[model samples]
Target chain A: MNASTLWIFLPILTGALLLFLRNQRWVAFVAGGLSFLLALTAWLLPIETTLALGSYAFKLSSTFEILGRRLILTTNEQPILTLIYGAAAFWFIASPSVDKAHRLAPLGLVQVGVLVAALAVEPFLYAALLIEVAVLLTTPLLLSGRDKPGRGLLRFITFQTLAMPFILFTGWLLRGIEADPGASALIRQAAILLATGFVFLLAVFPFHTWIPLLSEETSPYLTGFVLWVFPTSALLFATGFVDRYAWIRTAPQLPQILSTVGALMVAGGGLMAAFQNNLGRIMGYAVILETGFSLLTLSLLKTQGIDLFFLLFVPRLLALALWALCLDILRQNAASLSLQDVRGLARPWPFASVGLIFAHLSMAGLPALAGFPIRLAILEDLATVSLSVAAWAFIGSVGLLAAAVRTIAILVAAPAELAWEARESWPQRLFIILGGLALFGLGAFPQWVLPLLNRLPAIFEHLGG
Target chain B: MLLNWLAGVLILMAGIGLFVSRDWRWNLGAMALQYLAAFWLVHASWPLAASAVKLITGWMACAALGMTLASARTEPGKEHGWRDGGFFRLLAAVLAGLVAFILATRLSAWLGIAPPIAWGSLTLMAVGLLLIGITTQPLRVILGLLTLLAGFEITYAAIESSELVTAAQSVITLGLALTGAYLLVAAKEETPQ
Candidate 1:
């Protein structure tokens, strides 16, 4: 396998060994160290290059046949693949605290599975099998210990599994059209099926209860991995179908459909999150809302939309990584994830809480944080379309921002009790510096990042302040 | 020629018998009859090579049944009725007929005959989804899921056949069934007499 393939699989290969390692600390250190090296390698790989399925050799730029179909990898995919795997590696490394408590091996395996699934051709169809494997993998995680499998995991699996047949049948139907191009009826059927399958998989509105339940049941770090990696991978994989099927991308009604669904998700999930008592659930809803925003951007059907999708993805991943890390470190002290439990938490763990607030604000798309730019860009794009469209985008942005404000309000409410003194850990301080540098870097010099994020889609590029 | 149709009718009848019969033994008999019908159907269609594979799968299934029966027999005789609420049985029966009829119609359509859209497959799928959606009873839902799956198989078989992907999909279904069975077995083990 070339570096791109190797970059994704290396951690997975090490995860197996992690299971056998007696010293959890060493497993954490080694796995993290190796993953960082791999991430660096991934970052260095030439963008938009394809590694043929049969040939291991690096083809700087070539498209060859695989099983009677062409599998092409372009420079556009390089940043995406690098960002996902590299970010995952960083999160896995930063999450040493949780790695000690839960078996990291299985979660790592699932992460790899999701990556492979996303990287695979026809992720729309392939995702079903991958999701099944993830469910199977989750069963052991869900069933771990004397703790009964919670309603959340059960619900998550049930909803996920139900979506499976839709995807498979959609694939089956779509496969038929290759031979019978005149089968317009069949094409429409496949599109509806595919759309529903994705809607269910992404836990789009009405199917979103599972996200909170799962986040609550699983370790925060693992939950963060699911929230960030899985959906992003699915979305990336979905882009392939959008790119491949002219009917889906070019359909006149498709963008409107996506926008409507997205608006509903944002409004519903945001409102729900605004009222939730549980922090994890709130984060879950926020992520769901963000997913909605992403969908809204995607519906624009421009390269700018894709770029915004990519740009929004980066900060969300970073924020969730920090969020999961904070939860992992603090879950031991809190009776529950309710704001009350976290009231005085910041006092004891100032750095972690600061990280949480930063992440939350970024999640909220506040200014100087990563979320702000993307949200603004999406809004600007919406304005060009219609006043009502811009209004809806504004409402969604407000909801996300409101959620963040609530979290900050809760944290600051009982600052004396919640504020945690920073530990003297040099490594943690280093991480804080890195996170701050990133936040500030993205914030102050929005210009430099805008070029990178602007490469997204035109809709987002126009929104760059 | 008539034997195939006869076997199909017998399987449908057995499925109905499973619904009406309160006795667990009778229900088992219906399942057994259904299995036999499946065996006959396979024998009538594919050559011995494919038949051999089906036969092996059948024998393995029989082994599982034997184990289930032996376990039940080993238990102390309680005055429990043989009835299984007949919910799954009824559901399964309705679904099987619906699926079979749908499959027949679709197969005819694919062969250039304009047969109607058999509502049977749709019914089977609907009932299966209902069973799975509403209930937490693993075994009942499993039976429902199996019925639903059978409906899918019929529709799929009518359209096209890629034995590899089909086999792969079947393996997944079987895996789900096995997981459900394990859950049932584990639950049975958990409860005290």
Candidate 2:
């Protein structure tokens, strides 16, 4: 059996079947268990190699072909598969308690499965197509079919659709450039096309309006999952482009451009996040801020960057999941997530309040939490290149810190007569506490993730080298 | 040669009609005709079977969307006079078409494609974007998106012609329409009892 079929097709087929099961709890267990099993298999089984269980032996192939195109997931990519599916399991396992509609498990599974294909698909440009498919899959999940569609959702779909043509055209242009080396015009056009495509896909700076908008317009859990999955795949695809193309990798200004753009995104998302009143919008801006940091780490890949990029993922995902869960819980109990609406919410829901505060502070890179070490390391690397880049990134972090403080103060602002109580259900509290603890645990010992992260960059041959 | 010019004319008309009209039926019809013309133009380069799929897929998209809007509760598209930004929009659209005309020749030469193909692609794509930029309505945005993508596919088909890529683009087209149908029903103020 091909690993692609195991990792990609199997989950998609299962998700489709789960769609009809009609029981939310059953959907959660079946999907989550399957996701966890897939992650474990990817972690333990070496692809394209024979393995024996007692007297039985088998080999799982790394590549599969469909429609004359190849999907290959080598042993080097097993860690990434494990991480992606593990994250899927994280979201799915929590669905029964959080999602009443039963949509997240089945559709989320399908989207996750498709995103894995985006990472594994050969000729990498086809990844754009797969990403589009995933984005479309997410549209239905964004709405419960009872409410008016928000303009943010509409803009989100339009902008994502715009990206595919630019990327696909870049593929054709790149081939042209390859055939006619020294055709600088073709090379330049290709660069513009590829950059524009990514700008749209990554929701970079100016194109990022939809992030905060979508978060505020939809359920926090679904929007949070969309934010986490889409950009992670896009960034990896981008690194593929950089590693595969000599022109892009060899460009002396490439790192500078990346750092500058990264710094701007951090500054933009951070400064904007500081002023937002809605809890969901704050989560959105925080995501944008971390995505900026990811790019900063990405620019340094040839030096100490690739490892830093992968290291950023676990903490980032953990913080987002926790923050989203807290907001979701608050959303359920409160009138709205606005500052005034959720004020003094800590009186009844201390764990959720603490989870919310920790997740925000963790993303802000406060000392002793998950986001700090990688943030510090990236700044040091950026300073070596240019202090202004580091300064801009620092300023962005400070903005987020300010926002986190404001949130904490508001969450605790209650009258003395109010009594403290843990109103969160046991399952909700367990997920929130575990997520919060993972943030603290990962932050205090950064090396715990290094073994897995160290294996990830090899997925990009040139960058890893 | 005359037939190619006729195809180009039809593509331009379909794009402009969709760009200006508020009526969903008019938009879908123009888009449907636009896809047929696109197929005719691409037939100059691609296999008859491959290009024909574009026409079929595009029509199926129209049918899907048409059926949804047929059953869904939607307000009648009100006609606007010059006082309601209608004149300004008409003027703006002509300017957009002019820009496409000027750029179409250079794009044709640069990409080594036929002039008629370039003309149709740029016009449809530009007007599609204009449609998106102008309206907040779900149906309009999806129609605009379809036109924009149809333009892109025309140029892309001429360049790559890989059946897989073509099929993938078709899937996205149908997906967008189906998704649009969902959005329309969801956007309705009251669900049927």
| Candidate 1 structure quality by residue, lDDT tens digits, A1-465 | 343245444556676667677676676666666666654654465644555557565644324333333334444444454555567567656555554323554356445634554364333365565565555455544344444445566566566666767777777777777778779888888888888878777888788888988777666766777677657755665665676666676778877887788778777777777777777887788788888888888776553546666667767776777777676566656787787887766666677677777877777778888667777888788677656766766676577667667776766665344434665255655665576567656655556645444433321222222
Model 2 TM-score, all chains together: 0.97
A55-173 per-residue lDDT for model 2 (tens digits) = 99888998898787888989888999989999989988986667643888899999999989888887888888888888888878888888788888998999999999999999999
Q: How much is A180 displaced in model 2, in angstroms?
A: 3.1
Error of 1 at A429 (Å): 6.5
Model 2: residues >4 Å from true position, as ranges?
A: A53-56, B73-75, B190-193
List fnat per candidate, in order.
0.00, 0.59
- Cα misplacement distance, residue A244 of candidate 2 (Å): 0.5
- Candidate 2 docks at the CAPRI level of medium
Error of 2 at B59 (Å): 1.0
Compute the lDDT of residue A352 as modeled in candidate 2. 90
